[model samples]
Target: MQLFSTHKLRNIQAQEQAIKKHAILVVDDEVANRKVITSILQYEFIVLEASNGVEAIELVQKHPNPESISMVISDQRMPHMSGVELLSQLAKIIPKSVRIIVSGYTDVESFIGSINKANIYKFIIKPFERADFLWTIERALENFELQQKHDTHLLSLEYIVAERTKELADKNIELEQAYKKLEDISLTDPLTQLKNRRYLDKHIDAKVGLSLKAFQNWQKDTTNPLPHNEQLTFFMLDLDNFKSVNDTYGHEYGDEVLKSIKPLLETLFRSSDIFIRLGGEEFLIVVRDINQTDAQILAERLRKTIKQYVFVVNSYTNFSITCSIGYVQYPYITEQPNALSWQQVVKLTDKALYLAKNNGRDAWVGLSHLNNNINENEITKLLDPDEILTQNNTINLVSNITLTIK
Candidate 1:
């Protein structure tokens, strides 16, 4: 009971009109009967005549289009082939065409049982009324058009379903790709192609959480405690007079200098080491199993490389840049009375970096450790990466051993 839109209705009507344009083929062996049937139908339709079933089939083959010869009317009991036989052939050739049989007998036995076999639309007596004959022809054509419309409607529905399904699939792919891009942007610094501060915050929190859980376990049992042989080194780096570079050469050139250092830093460190940019010319390196001496050696090499390498801003403009670095090596040990968090160590590292900046612009400084008051609650709050990254400046520090990057 579905209704088609106005536009779709117009399309169906147009197709039906093309289908109805074909001539009606009237078959009869008798010359007078053939002329009589043709004459009657000629007023409303283009009528074609065939002497027998074979001739009728030949004419149908010539006009093989579904639109051609929409209906067939024939006299039964012909010389060679009967009306029923001709209609049977037409059924195979043009299945949609309406078939009708005519005869002189009042009680037609051949048609009586052959209606289903020949697929007859209607049958008329030989001495038939002109009104009844015309009415039968009109109804048969209407039946043919209705069948065409129904088939066309089914095909249209299938096409619409296919198109909509494809559209939904395309939208799903787009959504998935967009989600992946957002995930990448969250962890990456867009300018330097290095890990962002957010990634550092998340990573630091995860490490601290495990450490705090161990600290709590140690509190419960004074005998069993977490092992602290693993040491992590932090190289907090600041580009010397970076604001002056941007002011002199423009922000584009400043961005070029930042991007250019990534390969230099990557070559100096292992894959396990994490390189980070904390917005605007400040960078950090976190390496595992490293001491102040080894960390300062790496920082010195990086400073020398940057100072010597000509940063290519453009074909016409090239410049040299330098970075000052300070490192803090923090060690975690089992059963240590007052354990400092890595977050606290990061804060202390920042202070030592400022000392290097104050002494000389391009030198490096290293501190052995910042012995911290172990508060087990420190790890629980480490879940918020933003807070850990933006640590407050008011933390108290008890400092140990020291070194520098040339």
Candidate 2:
């Protein structure tokens, strides 16, 4: 290759003055080749030189902003590190640089192997013409500018997508909360602010399913201890004579008396236990993992609490109220003579409750051994399959569930 001619040299000097503001890096072990590459580009760009991959990496580290250098020209054949390897390292070091590989005819295959990794913009073999060399550099610079624009647009799109995704996720969370609120309102007793029968129809079935499973497990492993606290105690209670309060003092006074009892029930039972207001003047208390005595004690305390507390009728008149409670120990016959489901347990409790009502109210009665009447019909009822309703991945069985005391 020949040096730049006199007129060409003057033209190069003039071109350098008007060159656009961009940098180019040429890496080669041969000083002669570096000089040749630099001479052609020095007129049109800010030229940088590196003898090896190590030196190229050092230069990239020195310049904090790698985008300042736009093009990288690397010779493939080198001692410690090949040209392809150098460009590969430069990619990580300065990703914005458009890479070009300069190699001999024999080493063209070496660049092909790493072209995917190096993102080589052009491949120039040995003994290239000046016009082709200049043309390659010009195109590489143009591609670098186009790449910058693409990255900017891509970043803007990613930001917009991320923001939209977060907004949609937030909206889904709000919708779930609102749905829960509406569900609670539907299951609440308006007058007493207590969970109504709808809540019982679902929660009781889940608890009962657990009870049945435990009972089956106990039967299977009779020698082992009861599995995971399988006991459920139910207390059925009602105001002894709520109708008299309604008739004599009007329904408004009776309504107030029912609402007043909310705090008393909350205090009597545990926070974990579920409490339900069945309707006007009737309530149910559900207790779990308790002994027979503990169940009796809770029932007695509630009965006595109502009997003692003074209920203000009007501003002028104050009177006392009394409640009768009846609770039954679950799995009444643990010896397996009878497979007692929750429905049967409820029937036994209701029977005991009527016994309390029959014995002139204002008291609590526990189920005795005499009431354990296991007939064929009751056994059929216990084994019958309840209609299962699955909601939110939860299995809710709707049974032939009803309670009456007579």
Candidate 3:
């Protein structure tokens, strides 16, 4: 069995050697010159012969394996096409193939530029020695192999870089979406899906500052025929008897009532305005770019809407609720725009809401503006709007209720 296997291996080695032999194509118009070069190379290489450039091109095009034609050797002077012209066309077909040009004359400088254009591997003068010709052919083939390897390695590196870039881009997009989701969760009230105290605290100062700039700009422009009340207005609202809803029904039903307020607020307010649920049944709205008259009108409308709309907890559980509201414009005194800070203004608004609750359950009260000449002590007393407003006539009040002066 060992003797039989050794004989089979020898046959396989011989076949591999024949397959590895280099194929050389020699193109020349003269039959004698073709025979001379073929005789020199035939022992080592598989020499293929072509009479001219056209025949040489046809042979290469018809070859089964393009890489099998390892080298092409052509004479410089030939009919129809010169050696440089033939090699330029072959460069487009099999760029990895080595090319050589043989010239009869020793004028190397004359055709050297054309040889470069054809990407010719070497220029040989005729009557060259057999040893020099063989050396030139071997060197050209080695150079061709090196270039092919370099191109393949560069392509592999480019592919890896492209894949890594795509992966990084995909990861960046995922991180952005996740961060957006977390931010939304942090700023929203889970029960009502309304803006929470954190959201209001984060944005109220900037909103107030921007509104102040707008109010100052309008004041400077005397030609602009708009009222000074065109500014940011804060509204504080409370459900009249919201605790009874939780007492009669469970807290789950009270949550449904809270959720119902989001759609109601959206219907009456502009998208640019801020709305927040300040825990329990109390809510806050920051109305933008409105005068006292329009602000009072909106406050009344919100009260009526809440009184009329039915809160549906389930198939058979339905009830109606009412809200008491109080509103105050920022820069309460137009002459002294920064007379009272926003926090103090909101406290006055809360006092007005208590006045509404005291006079009647479903009502809206507004503090239009404070007197320009009020003393600092009087300004401090403005928080208890009922006694100060009735005694001194220092604050002007607007309301939707009849005889609402508490």
Best-performing candidate as measured by TM-score = 3
Ranking by TM-score: 3, 2, 1
Per-residue accuracy of model 1 over 6-88 as CA lDDT, tens digit each: 99988987776555474788888889988887878776777888898898888878875645777888888887788888888
Between candidates 2 and 3, the one scoring higher on TM-score is 3
Model 2 residue 112 lDDT score: 73
Cα displacement (Å) at residue 292, model 3? 2.6
- Candidate 1 TM-score versus the reference: 0.52
Clashes of each: 3, 0, 0
Cand. 3 Cα-lDDT:
0.83
Badly placed stretches (over 4 Å) of model 3 are: 1-27, 31-51, 54-72, 89-98, 128-135, 201-210, 227-230, 313-317, 330-348, 370-394, 402-406
**Candidate 2 — which residues are off by over 4 angstroms?**
1-22, 27-56, 75-85, 103-119, 142-157, 221-229, 244-253, 313-317, 336-341, 371-373, 377-406
Q: Report the poorest 10 consecutive residues by lDDT, candidate 3.
A: 384-393
Q: lDDT tens string, model 2, 279-387?
A: 7788887787776667766777888888998988669999997887777656665544245766666665665666577667887777633332455664554334341
Ranking by lDDT: 3, 2, 1
